[model samples]
Target: MANGFEAAMRMMRSRDPQRAEDGFGLLRDRAAEYLPALIEEFENEQADRGLRSWLLELIGLAESAEALPVLAAQLNSQDEMLRDWAVAGLTRLDTREARTALWRARANGTIA
Candidate 1:
């Protein structure tokens, strides 16, 4: 689909920090509207490593329980940064699933 979402996605991936910031803001402002697409982008195998944590932060900012699984999955990522953002996301979500994942991560010694 050639929706403006693709354009926003490009901006979010821009080399220019400001463009990426603006795009992230757009996604955050419309988190409910853009979450499904954002989640799809998050799952893209070719997704940039630099932006993966950023996207995770934005998803955390969305504070949607539907994001619990995605955030929880990141808790097990080798990237400690992703684990931190996932913790923040799970905290924001505060759902049972999110909480359980947080506990599991802590128990597994991933997060202190």
Candidate 2:
């Protein structure tokens, strides 16, 4: 079962949007145990734009406060797209910290 879940996560990182969305949906439904692993995979996959974006969307759907630090880290990403997505994800959270981070990123020119 664990291996199957891992495999599903790997599929979620696929280039195909449908596959990614399906896998992410599964994980999102059963995310209690997989959250840590998903966060690690998403953070490590910074080079894959599609995967990263999908991961961010997953994180947004998860709406776990645990994702705050990971999303915050991306605020410093050299990739403008990643930074923008991070800000957007944080805004989706709508927490005070998330809002503050978004404001700071915008002020610092990391987001626009």
Candidate 3:
């Protein structure tokens, strides 16, 4: 399972956007199993920008409120791009906690 998850992530980092989207799409269906890896990749400075963006979109698709804390921590990332993506992902969550966290991050300028 781990190997498969890693392969999916590698695909998501591929140069082809279609491949990346497909990889992320597969992970979305198994979000509970992939959330940790997704969060890890999102926080990895070495990860591709496109892959990170796609991961954020996947988080939104997963609607896993469990990802909220990790996403919130990203709100404090030094990279503005990461912070922005984190904010965007948070909005996808329908929970009140997600909304509250997003509002706070926005008010504090973590996101535009």
- Give the top-scoring candidate (lDDT): 1
Model 3 clash tally, residue pairs? 0
lDDT values, one for every candidate: 0.82, 0.75, 0.75
Ranking by TM-score, best first?
1, 2, 3
Question: Which ranking of candidates, highest lDDT first?
Answer: 1, 2, 3
Which consecutive 10 residues in model 2 have the weakest lDDT in total? 54-63
Clashing pairs in 1: none
Query: Candidate 3: misplaced stretches above 4 Å?
Result: 45-47, 76-81
Please identify model 1 stretches exceeding 4 Å from their true place.
Answer: 45-47
lDDT value for model 1: 0.82
Give lDDT tens digits, candidate 2, residues 34-83.
Answer: 66776777867756777777676666556667878878888998767667
> What's the count of clashing pairs in each model shown?
0, 0, 0
Candidate 2 at 80: error in angstroms?
2.6
- lDDT tens digits by residue: candidate 3, 1-112: 9998988887777778888778877797887667777777766735466666667656655668778887777788787776776777777775899888878877987676
Model 1 poorest 10 in a row by lDDT: 45-54
